[model samples]
Target: MTTELERELKQLIIDTLELEDVTPEDIDPDEPLFVEGLGLDSIDALELGLALQKTYGIQLQADSDDTRRHFANLRTLATLVEERRVK
Candidate 1:
């Protein structure tokens, strides 16, 4: 991913997760920041999903089964943005 994309993803993560201790520079592209890394729980996922819809206009259907893949990590989120951008 490009630097701009990475930075945007970092900002999204920080904003969505309400991570007061983390900065854009702290997130690793390939690292998992949910269960095993950042310890985010299911509530965080719900909140992040809502925030993502509002911020990026990428609607993630709550009833869909792709929630895991969509919120997998920073890499997946960034790729989703690149793929779904309105342009």
Candidate 2:
């Protein structure tokens, strides 16, 4: 059901971060997006946040816990986009 959005979010993460070695198929929707799992740093988070905002008209707080939650994984990101994206 949520597979399509998850793939889109995965592609967004890959492109937004310019991760040359990572592909959407390599990402696990349930994996953590940070240090332990995908190993994304804070900078990647910022870039990805911007991409999400530009692509979906989603707003984010740089230091918000809610932002942390929404960035936790591909599924979470897809959920956020689904809930808050403007058209």
Candidate 1 deviant stretches above 4 angstroms: 61-65
Q: Give the top-scoring candidate (lDDT).
A: 2
Q: Please give me the total number of clashing residue pairs in predicted model 1.
A: 0
Best by TM-score: 2
lDDT of 2 by residue, 1-87 (tens): 448778888888888888899977789888899886899998888889889989999977666798899989888889899999995
Consecutive 10-residue window with the lowest summed lDDT within model 1: 56-65
C-alpha lDDT of all candidate models, in order: 0.76, 0.86
Tell me each candidate's TM-score: 0.81, 0.90
Tell me which residue pairs clash in candidate 1.
none
TM-score of 1: 0.81
Candidate 2 at 77: error in angstroms?
0.6
